[model samples]
Target: MKNRNVILTGAGTVIPWGAPSTDKLTDILRQDSIFINDKGEPIGEYLYSLLKTQMGKRRAYNTPNFESILHFIELLFEYKKSRYSMSSSFFRINDFFLIDPEIQNKLEIYESQKLDKRLDTSFGTKRLIANEYYYYELYLHFTFLIKKEIEKYETVEEKYHELNKSFNRFLHQVKGENGIVRFYTLNYDYLVPKISNLKFFDGYDEKTGKMNVKKIIEDDYIDCYYHLHGSFKLNFIGEKSNDYSVCYVQKNFVQNNLIPSNIITGYNKPERILNETFYEFYQKMIEDLIKANKIYIIGYSFNDMHVNAALKRALKKGSAKITVVDKCSLEDFHLKYDKIIDSNPDYDMNKLIKFPNTYQMTTEALKAKAYLNGLNDFLDNLIRSNN
Candidate 1:
């Protein structure tokens, strides 16, 4: 009778050796490093060079910082797919034409046509090409950098296979009427679905080649993967341009002949969560969590204000038991939640019945608590018996 919903955050929470995946992203971030030169002064030469090469005759936007540039790119993609339509064919086409290189060249030509006169002229064309080249080059560099760093650890592929084995073992041993494993992740990475062997709820019928609202139940196993922060790979209509959307480089672009780089960074915006398509996805995930008997939080800092609010809302609707798997001590964890709880005056900390059901421990400790002998065995036995 134990229904567990596992939520895992990325970054600092899932560190293997005191380093998060973001560490590998530094090279890409610093590729166009904007800092002072060796003379203890701003590197005007580099900035000017980039401006000349990338901006051309186009009037610069009010915000010229790298953050703005990145945000602009992200927004451009967001504006394109305003409809939030979902079609496998569209997905495949975008992946091939917009994501992969073979088709990206064609997309670039198409995109060029839509540019304003300022951006469509010879100078603009040259700047666009240069900017595109720079962007893609940086992307490839980052990909390789991450790949190299990943190689240092056990291969994600290998880890995924191992995790699968563990999951299968857990499922086989834990018998119940509800054979559902609810998974929530803060990672922008797509490792969970790849490992879990789960597919999006597209409601596609292979035999008829038609879309249907009826759910497809594959086998007796059902694993639900929920993305807490928007997925890095999920394609969204861009905010800047109306012609294109953001997509995954590998799945949507590389395999399909579309571009192989993400156009946006800094995806933790409140507005993004409320996007029509994303809102539905979030609602479905919340519903699943609410129906669960127990909640497992892993690899999350619980610092994201929006996510924390959402979790609190969900908790308010349900009376499920909660367990936090983190590196911090119980007192520290309580203090962290205390801030969240204190923010809402309606919820009194002393009378908060939900807090008693919460538990915290490190991943290693949690694993030990569930498997090891002596104290671990006693704890696991007690928990299982109580449940």
Candidate 2:
């Protein structure tokens, strides 16, 4: 009965479910759109005001590069942090965030060449540290904004109803439900569990109210969920939980100590994944990938190096086939996967691969009658095969 192997979905699969895509989120960030809080204050204006004030107070505004750096940091942090909320920073103490190669490279180059004075000065250091906290605060604001947006979708009911409808239609088409079709996501949106009734596990033992990755693996679970990046509800060590202070999943979020945001973002994503909790989640994903006979990627973009590496390793270790369902062209998709495949040349390049023949379809277009029928048929045939 375990005919079709695994179904891997990215943020794109949820587009029909009311989540923003990568391009849409980027478009939103480029604008000066005003989002209001429950208190009716314009949050975007407030964020800009805070950024300007913080930089000015630290005398970073005097530096020609300050405004540009601030803008870059805001955009960078917002892009990564907003992903989980729509679907979906900080200074670290400056040194913390700067450890990321991309952010660090940008800052060092800006400082060395563009700064009016040597960045080694006490004032420069204060400025860097100040921006760190400013970015962190901005991240908090974004979290609040996402929570507000999710509230607009009839909280959990309507959203989950929609998910169940679409996904059940999908499940009805598959050959068999024998093998567990695990959903491993980089998204932080907390809506997937409500949509499916299958045994949902995300490395945290809800029974104990702690993140025990081993207990998750040891359990006799046929179906398991892995949040490769992290989730909004669970708070990690360094993350700042929005005042909600309660995970949406807990029976009593107020009474129980919720897991913090155990996610990886910004430039430190790969580095943070090395931490114990994330490392466990990632290792387990690779394990599952190897066991799967077929892999179906729905909305994923295949951008993360860590994920790509795991997928490649899984392909090398097993004969699992791949199917990508996204708007990207076959060429583009192949190129992206090739980035993973080319990294390890010894692995066989040929395996059953399929994608949407129609290009440039919106998430809506992709879900249209023609495409959906084609997709369902393709998957059915793939799963029905006894080969």
Q: Lowest summed lDDT over 10 consecutive residues: which window, candidate 2? A: 250-259
Q: Which prediction has the highest lDDT against the true structure?
A: 2
lDDT tens string, model 2, 184-251? 77766656666665656666656654676567567534466667776655553422332333323211
- Compared with the true structure, what per-residue lDDT tens digits does model 1 show for residues 168-282? 3433333245546666565544454444334533222445533222342232134555454543332233111222233323222122222233222232244445532344445
Runs of candidate 2 exceeding 4 Å displacement? 1-4, 27-132, 150-163, 172-177, 238-262, 343-387
Q: Global CA lDDT of candidate 1, please?
A: 0.39
lDDT of each: 0.39, 0.48
Q: Give per-residue lDDT, candidate 1, residue 229.
A: 50
Using all chains and alpha carbons, the TM-scores for the candidates as numbered come to 0.48, 0.58
Please list the residue runs of candidate 1 whose C-alpha ends up more than 4 Å from where it truly belongs after superposition: 1-9, 12-19, 23-28, 31-155, 159-164, 167-177, 197-222, 236-268, 329-332, 339-387
